[model samples]
Target: MLRRLLGSPAAVSGHLHRSLSTHCVSTNLRRSLSTAASSSSHPPWAIIDYNTLVDDSPSSWAPGACFDPLQPPRVSRISAPPHLLRPRERPGPGTNLVQLLTGHVTAASADGHLLLTYYDIIAEGPRASWNQTADMEVERFICNPISGQLLRLPYVSGSRKRICYHRMGLLTQPGPGGARFAVADIVSQRERVIDRFLPELGRWDMVVGLPCQPTPEREMDMNQETVAFGGRLWWVDLTCGTISLDPFSYRPELRFVHLPTGSTLTSHIHTKSESAEERDEVAKYRRVGVSEGRLRYVQTSLHEPFVLSSYVLDEEASSWALEHQVELKQVLADGGHECKNRPPQIAVLDPMNAHVVYITLGEQEHVVAVNIYQDKVIGSAPLQNRYHYLLPCVLPPSLGSSQFPETGKKGDMEAIDVLVSCGRHYKG
Candidate 1:
């Protein structure tokens, strides 16, 4: 009876045989799973990537992975005076745990803890004039911060013009055979369209029905940052509407939803003719992000004390509602010097903890966390100025390899090579 319930060895290994026959396991999957199964028997660690600004040194632009941000010190359970509990010290400038390749990190998979970066290599010498278009070769790569495994992705054919403006995102999950992952991107210029990379097929597939047209008068652009929430990928337009796509569907679907009336992010925009400087000034004060599985909008004013207004998307009502409105003075008592020059760039680092938000202050590039619910500053860390240009991604804890097969026989290796080389393409 026990043998029947558990199945014989042949029956137990049948699934593995089928996976080998189908050639579903990829090189990345094999490497990641094997490494995880052999490594220390501990939970996977969570980390974040901090992409620095341009620097003369070739290596300075690489991302710095940090593990300390999410692991706050724990308090003792033993009874004691509150004052006796030592406060947790903030991370210093030298706390970066790992340094990755130099490139523009375009997307991050919070679930898988993977990073996608785009690097442009000038094939020819410098052009004589800035207006002259030079030969540019673009390369895309995805890397695992924990394992330091990097894979070069095949080039996707399209207009290279304004490639820097393109947006990318990653999604991953365990499949019947092994782990599967997909990378998606949106390029908008002449026409708006979506492209996704399917690992199983090893090719790019385009999804239609995206509302890419921007009114001639507005000339709006899609925000470069993307959020993967509730099984859909979301992108916010500069004009205040969101574009969502379901990548896993048989025929991917795209939808756009407008922001609520009073919660419109453009409340501060002025229609009157103004100098280029004034227009750029207003653009610096607004940001869009996701928090607690909902879309969030943050807007700040140019005046003193920097009043910040935050809004949350009310999914059921199909609208946004004002969530928090707090002045910088109320939170950061000193009102750091950077506040006077420009508004801080805001990002919701911990969506699970809706109260905390990450903000980047001026030239100094001090990354600080503020608690909206408590109405106080929580932590502060000095970010190197060189890493300021890249977007900050909050990666969740690693999903260790223990979930996959611990070992594969020689036959499995042969099968994977044959399958990968054939370049079989599968459509969702």
Candidate 2:
């Protein structure tokens, strides 16, 4: 009966108006039958030759997945390399989008716009090798998702001054594009440590402030070590060695925490009698990132690639406790260089999403991107230039609108991009 429907090999091929490409026709038929049986309600095994049931037509796809049929086609390919679009691709009466040179970027959503944190954009002249002729400038790119436009805050307060801690990055969503971001800066003109706000709905506001502290010299470290989680800004203080940050509710709290050590993760592997020294060493840690108002970290003194440790913050008691410790080797596979570098800096790429992508510079100065979700090293690339990088942000999602809006778009997909930067190399 089965053979009767398909007819003979030559007859079936003729019916389909095509020749069989593979000799294993019987095996292919078996698999096709299995799939048809699995979803019998869909259709029958009408030997269509190829099994690519794709309708790339925008009309066949769901709404938002494609564009409206009434409007002209709104989709087209985005060309790169020789076609890598330059800013002012065609000079017109439009906004000057922030040009991201070789640097780190992390964008998240804030009030519906893309809050893009772009670090120091160093200048490198192709002809002169790498010689800078000007002072560094810190810039923040705020792109409105709806308009597909970006705004650059090149100078703070519209003056020649720069923003504090432009290296590490500003807070936003967790991806490779602009979302939204919040920053905390102390007023230099006025002696008040204040929290600045830039909500999706309106302008910046001084929402919070600290008592007082001695200001560092111009060249010294003045950046507030900040991370965004539970919806607010928080940081690790080197002077006090404690975390002072804002929660999702916009309240500030200070907590003491420590990172985990390789020794600790190893002891868990084997050993009934774990040494006291090993235990003591593992217990001591530093702030890494926070999750659900809980603090997380990794061992600082560790000279080798090890595990990532997170500590949960006990607000009532004002103390820290261990939460999760996943072996860094399990993900990194190769020994991480951040362990080789002295004071290691690592941050959970996105806390909202369980897929944590940690960014750290290794001994060879390779910036590694580790995936916490799949337990693997997703990306490892060398920094093009040199400047002690402070912040690296994972950008948020955006419209990434199709170039030819006049063309009704077809099947489009989502993607993630990363932003990172070294210090001020080209002063220009």
| TM-score, per-candidate, Cα-based | 0.63, 0.40
Clashing pairs in 1: 52-387, 53-386, 53-387
Most lDDT-accurate candidate: 1
Worst ten-residue run, lDDT, model 2? 70-79
How well is each residue in 1-428 modelled by candidate 2, as lDDT tens digits?
A: 11211122111100111111222112222222123223222110000111011112222211111000110001110001111111223223454322222212222222333333322222223312322332234344443322223344433454332434321324444333334345444333133334354433233445334432232221111122345544544444322323334422344433333222232232242244643233222322343444333444434335444556555555542445665556674356554443533433452323433345444444325555565546666656554323222222221222332111111211111121111110101111
lDDT values, one for every candidate: 0.44, 0.31
The residue-by-residue lDDT of candidate 1 on 273-353, one tens digit each, is 543334333334555665666677776655667777777877752557888878775467653434645666553344556
* Model 1: residues with Cα > 4 Å off, grouped in runs: 1-102, 123-131, 158-165, 188-192, 209-219, 260-284, 334-338, 390-394, 402-428
